[model samples]
Structures are given as C-alpha cells and as structure tokens.
Target chain A: MKKLFTGVCVAAALSLSGQAALADVLDDIAERGVLRVGVKADYPPYGYLDEAGNIVGIEPALAQDVADLLGVELELIPVVSSNRMQFLEQGRIDLMIATMTDRNDRREVVQIVDPNYYSSGTNILAPTAAGLTEWEQLDGLPVCGIQGAFYNRKTEEEFGAEIVAFTGTAEALAALQQGTCVAFVYDDSFLISRLSEPEWADYEMPLQTIDDAPWGLAVALGEDRFAELMSGMIVNWHLSGRILALETEYGVDNTPFAERMHQLFLDINPSIER
Target chain B: MDGIEAWFLDLYHTTGINLTIVYDAFDRERFLWGLLNTVILSVICLVFSVIIGIIGAWLLGARHAIPRRIVQAYVQFFRNTPPLVQMYFFFFALGPMFMTTVERHVGQMVFVSETPLLTSFHWAVISLSFFAGAFNVEIFRSGIEAVPRSTIEAAEALGMSRWQIYRDVILPLAFRICLPALNNNLVNLVKTTTLAYAIAVPELLYMSNQIWSDSVNVPEMMTVLLFVYVGLVAILVFAMQRWERAMKLPGFGR
Candidate 1:
C-alpha cells in the first residue's frame, strides 16, 4: 500500500512540475486561439447568469473585451468568489474577471493586475427613516454585516457600533429588513445595486464611502508578462473611456470615486490617447 | 491508485495538481492558535455539558412530575432543534440584550478590538453546552438505568443514605456503563465546535477561512482544515480510548 501511494505521489508531482514548465500562458492562449476567463455567475451587475442562461454582467463583458483584444475565442468559465482564484492558479482559466478585491495579502499568492477595473467602498445601508447622516451616529447602535468582510473589524472599532455579523450577505440583509440592526454595512457598489431593486427601495445608503477597495483582475503567480499585459489593457480602457461606457451600459453607479480613478489613469498614462 | 493519493488528487483540478499552494499559504502560528482555540472551546463545552448532563440526569430521576417534565422539555427542544439556528438565536436575539444589561450596570459598553468579544464568546459557549448537554442527558440517563437495580438495593440495605448510594454506588457504576456513549458525545462536541465559526469565534475553521480568503487558495486551505479536524478528532479518540482502558471495570462492558 505504501509503495503504491509513493508511486502515485511521484506521478502527481511529476505531472504538476511538468505542467508548470511547459509553456508561457500568453503564448499558449495565442496558439490555442482561446482565452478562458473565470467570471462570477451569481453576483449581478458584475457577473451573473441572465434569464437565457448566458453569463451577462460588467465583469463578463470585460472578459469579452479581453478576449477581443487578444483576438481569441472567449470561453466564460463560471466561478464563484471562493473558487475563482483556485481556478486561475490551477490553469482552469487564463484570467479571472470575478470581482476580486485587491489586497496586499492576496497579492502574495495571486498576481493582481494593476490599474483596477472598478472601485468599491464600505458604506452604511440604512432604512430611509433611520436618518443615519454620519459615521459617528452609528455609535452605540447595532449594525448587521457579513462575516469575514474586511470592514467588519474597522466598523466595530472606528464607529463603536455593535456588529451583528452573519455568514452571508443575504442573512445580513434579512436581519436589517427585520430590524435586527439599525443598518446593514456592506460594499457601496453592491448596496447601490441592491437599492435599485424594488424590494430594497426603502433602504438608502446613508454614509459616504468609508474605506475604498479597488477590484482587480488576478492571474497566477509568476505570470508577470500576462499580468503586465492585462494591467496595460485596463489602463488603455480607462484612458479611452471604455470602462465608464461599460459602467453606463451595465447600469453601474457612476460614483465620484470611479470618475477620479479615470482621471488618474489618464494622467498617468499620457502616452495612450483617447 | 492508493486511497489517500486518489483522494488528494480529487481535491485539485484534473489537468494539474499543485500542493505548493498549501505549503505557501500555511501559517504555522495562526493555525496553531486556531487549533488551541478549537481545543479550548471543545474542552470547555465538554466540561459544562457533562456537568449539565449529570445534574439533568439526577433531576430526571426526581419523584415530582413537573420538574421531570421541564427537564424532558429542555432535552427535547434542544436535541431536536438545529444547532446552527440555536447559535443564531443566541448570537442575534439574546446577544444585544446581554450587552445592554451589562452596559446598563457598568455605564459603558465593554469591548475588545472594537467589538464585544466576551459577549460573543460567552454566547458561543452557552449555545454549544446547551446543545450537547441535551444529548448527554439521554446518554447519562440510559447509563444510570443500565446500572443493575440489585446494586442500588444492596446499597440501600446497607443503610446507606440516598446521596451516599448515588455518589458511592450508583453514579460510579453508571459512568462505567456509559463510558462508550459519553466518549461518542465528546467526539461529537469536538466536531460541533466548527459551528462556532459561524458566529465569528475565531476558532480553527474561522481562522482557516480568513487564511483562505487572504491567500485565495481555497483547495489548499480546505485540505488544511480537513486534516486539522481529523487530527483533533483522532487525538480525542485516542485519549478517550486510553482512559477507557485505564478505567476499565472488568466484565462491565463485556
């Protein structure tokens, strides 16, 4: 039994090493004429399956643009937030346009492409009647939020609000609707999308953006060439206003944060013309 | 072809398998701390639930019908309801009330790292104890009943008081008979400690999830979680088996 196990381990390790050293991803994609991209199939206005089962959203559209730029067929591989990076690192997808937030910790394992595609920030989603006008007003009030969110600890300490965190955003929203908390604290872009739904019409974003986190595309580690190419493509998109056009087409809120990022991208990339 | 290797390969994508992600993302200190928290939570819950079980079992033997029914209701309600729902009820519904009461008395909200850690951890312990205690009640009761009635009669005939008969005679014998069931309950209690992560208790699973999110290596992190739990449960089972052998009442389990 032990010998057989050792043999299999050797085989697996050999295959993994062989696969890693085999080819450059950009060249592989170019040679194959296919760009497989992992995209969220559940989050709306970012990436979600339409009524016809087509993957349609801002992220998927951006993935299509990437494939178009590469002059290859786009294969949309549906991915959730949890499994998207694994899919990228394991070579299941060439790129990840899955609404992944750029953070220093994630940068160690996955190469997050520079020139963020979009910006999101933590905000308070409160009932319109609550009149929660400022951040300090949350002091001593109960706030519901999803567990494991980056802003959970910050919201707790900075605002002095008692956080009632749940395992998912759905539960957090439900708790807020049921008045378990004075407000639901989550990403501003997600809350903005939620506010458009008739069910969530009564909820209003009361506080301005607290902590802005940019969303970036992720590639496997050691894919420096692929990362630089993708990053440059995003910069070009920002300079040409393609990103803002997609935002309008997808009904994403044209927040001031995004506008400023656009200006910054144009300012930095003077060699690229609109 | 072997079982372990096949299982390991199934954890990754079929085209290529990389275990480096696991090696790279592994945080020895954080994982050790998480393991410690899990062990501490499980031990605390096990101790409290055993206490609740013994008290509950004794009360269940009461002559009065009302108290027996109350104990019966507690055992029934807790054992039947999902532990996850019970966790939410305690964390969401009762947690704020507890904080308010504390604040009312102290004139300020007590916090650690900007949140009420004590209150949340308190609720996590309370929920787990009550949940497991319900099952332990039945286990203990059956253990007590399995004790030969002739032994109790023998202690009574020796002019032993009720408390004496229970403590010196009945309880010791009952524990011997119930050792296997009690060990099973303790193992289950260890497994259920993962549920504490849902309430953000920073136990093993919660910390592992934090690492996985930060690293974006779900497969690697999940493998770590699975092995950590398996190791924990194995240690508990091994310890219990050793203790059972040491305390083996000859011919009792046989």
Candidate 2:
C-alpha cells in the first residue's frame, strides 16, 4: 500500500509540473495553426449562429480574417458574457472577440487591444403605449433591466426609477412584452438588434443615448506579444477596407449610429487603405 | 444626511438623468417571473434530489460491502468537485445526449415543434438536481445511521417487515434528524439556480449583466445586485430556520 501511494503521488506531481510547463497560449496557437477565439454565440450581427447552425457574424468574420493573416485557422468557441473573462485567463481560448466594452476593471485583468472597432451608448426602450418622452417621465415607474448592467445605480440615483433587474436579456424582454415594466434599459446596439427582430418591432426607443462606450478585444493580461499581434490584425483589417466591407454587408451603414461609429473608426486609424 | 445630499448632488452633476430611471427599469412582471422561476427550479430540484438521496442512502447503507463501496466512491467524486464544473460538463458535454433523448421520448407528446426536446429550463433543473442530489445522499445516509439500531430490531421482533419498519419508524426518525441539514441544502439549491444564467436561461443575474454592460456604471449596478441577492438569500434562510424549528424533536436539545 505504501509503495502504491508513493507511485500515485509521484504521478500526480508529474502531471502538475507538466501542466505548468505548457507553452504560452499565443505561442501554442501559432504553432498549432489555429486561434481559438471566445465569442458570444447569441449577440446578433456580431457573434451569433446563423439559420444553418453555422457560427457566422461580424466578430467571427473578423477573427477568421485575422487567423488567415496569421496563417492559422479560426476556431470560434461560443462563450456567454459571464464566463468570457474566465475562459481567456484559463487558456481555454487564445483571445476574446465578443462585444466586450473597455472598462478599467476589465483592463486590470485583461489586455485590451488598441483601436476599438465600435462605439455604443446606453439607451432605454419603452412600449408605444407608455408614451414616455423624457427621462423624468420614468420617475416612479417600474423599469425592467438585467442585473450586472452598468445603469441600475445611475437610473435609481439620477432618475429615481424603480429598477427591476433580471439576469438575462430574454427575461428583460419578456418582462417588457408582458407589461411588467413600462420601459427596458439596455445598450443602443443591442436595442437596435432586438428591435429589428419581428417580435420587438412594436417597441421603440424612448430615452436618448447615454454614455458612448468603446468596445475592444481582450487577451490574457501580461501577454503583450499577443496583444500586439491582435492590434496589428485590426489595423491591417482597417487599412484593407475589410471593416468597411463588413459594414456594407451587414447594412449597418443604414443606421446613424453605425455611420458615427465608422467615422470614429477612421478618426482613430486614418491610414486605412480604403 | 451629508452623505445623502452629496450622493444626490453628485448624480445631478454627472448624468442629468434622475432617480426615475431606476423606477422605470423595475418591471414588477419580470421580477415576479424570475421569482417564479427561482421557486419552481428550487422545488422541483428539491423533490427530485430527495428521491435520489433516499435511494442512494439505501444503496450505500446496504449490507453488501462492494456495492456500498461503489456508491461511496460515486458520492465522493461528485461531492468533491465544484458545482460550476459539473454544470458546465453537463451543459456542454452531455447536453446533446439529453436533448436527443428528450426529443425522442417527449417531443411529440408535449409540443408541435420538431426540436421540442429538453428546453433550456429543463437542462437547468436536471443539472441542479444531480448536483444537489450527490450531497443529499451523504446527508441522508448520515441521518439514517444516526437512528438507533435498537429501534429497528424492536420493530422487526414485533413481526413488522423491513419495509414496514423503515416506513413507520426509521424514515420518520431519520427525516427529523436531517431537517436542519436538509434546510441548508434547499437554500443552497435556490442560490445555485443562478448558474442557469450561463446557459442563457434568462434568470436575474444574466439580465443584470446585460444592463451593466450597456450602462457603463458597473459599480452602481453591481452594488444594487449585491443587495438584491443578499436580501433574497436572507429571506430563504429565515424561512428555512422557521421550518427547521417547527420540525424540531421534543426533549432532544436539552
């Protein structure tokens, strides 16, 4: 029994050391000829599954192009909003191309790539029946939103809105549809995507856009080489007119916000080949 | 008073949006729906886990050593791993098998849609039930062992069958002893339902995340969410304590 126990302990220690000695994620990906990217599989036009069950969207398309430039295959790994950071840190994915906003807290933990692609702002959606025309109109009214969203405290402190927070977009939408809240608060891009759906056509934007936040790709912290590679891919994509092509393909150019976003992208990186 | 004024003043200086935005977002309908989901998930998992636990305890407590050892190993494996890992494995690894099984067995009976097998909600319940069930087995087994062996022997001597002895004496006594621990498990199961958010079940935490991601005021939103969760869990703990007290056996504590 003692000998068997010693053998088991030695085996366990070897396995632990072996795991510790594994190559850095970026190096491994370069050698393997594939970049495993963590992306949202639900958010439409950015990172979502198409009707044929294929993962095809703006982020996935961009990730594929980057992989091609690096001579690697793009392996899209579906990740939800909650676990995306954890996935990156654990080396489950080489990098994240989800619609992740640039925040200080996140920057502390992950490396944010330069030249963010899109700009988004917070906005509120109200049912046509609510007739809420201004922010103050929401005072004393029940508003439905998701938890962990950045606006719950601001909405309460600034507007005295009674916030009912749920866990996901589906629940918030369901609440709005079911007349639980007169309005629902979310990101402008998300609102546009949701409203474009057949089910949400009846809903309209009631509140003006709040803070305009930039979105960027994130890799593991301290991985400066990987960050540089990612930023270079993004810059090359811009110069190659690939970003513009995506905008035209998605018809995002139709929206004023997308036009504004396009201009911002150009402002940040003016040397695009387009 | 000074802090309150400063808070309000800061809000006015910064965003120009008033407190109404909070009220506007508080949809009673959605919150109630979330509450309903929470209760439904908790109750169903609770009942199923108890059933599993009872069976597991019986198997583990049996006279045969080999089978008992096997059951012991099963309990140790599950109980030792983190619940989140188990949830992920079940959702990502085993989900397809369960989905196919549900579609094959219950799809035609329940819904008109072809892909009607195993909705996200069903998967959430199953994952939580199995995770909780593993722990329940250990708790119930311990409770059963705590029962005096003399009582079971006396029932058997009175010509009562094994099943009758279990049903009349052992089960009641074991159940009473297990009440406090069982209450803690139930409360825990309720909180664990939040894991359903990862699979996009539209629970409370998922919605909050969507909101914060949009708003850019993560600290404020997170603080409120912390309070909301704390309040919800506290209420569950209080109610469970009451139930535990109600089920307390006389003369036992003294």
Model 1 lDDT at residue A199: 98
Clashing pairs in model 1? Answer: none
Every prediction's TM-score for the first chain? 0.79, 0.69
Considering the two chains of model 2, state its CAPRI-style docking category. Answer: incorrect
Give the Cα error of residue B124 in candidate 2, in Å: 1.8
User: Residue by residue across A1-274, what tens digits does model 2's lDDT show?
Assistant: 3443344345445433434344566568778988899988888877788889888888888888767766788899999889999999898988898989888899987888776665678888776545556776666666777776767757866887767665578766765654545678888878867765778766788666777788889989887656666665665455456776875676443334445545654675576525
Candidate 2 local accuracy as lDDT?
0.70
Q: What is the lDDT of residue A12 in candidate 2?
A: 40
Provide i-RMS per model in Å: 8.1, 13.0
Against the true two-chain complex, what DockQ does each candidate achieve? 0.07, 0.10
Model 2 alpha-carbon miss at residue A17, Å = 64
Q: Give the 10-residue window scoring lowest on summed lDDT in candidate 1 chain B.
A: B98-107
TM-score winner: 1
> What share of the reference contacts is kept in model 2?
0.24
Per-residue CA lDDT of candidate 1, range A82-146, in tens?
A: 88888987999999988888889888878987767787898988877666677877887788877
Using DockQ as the measure, which candidate wins?
Answer: 2
Per-residue lDDT of B36-116 in model 2, one digit per residue for the tens? 676677778888988888888878867789879887887887788877677656654555454221111121222111222
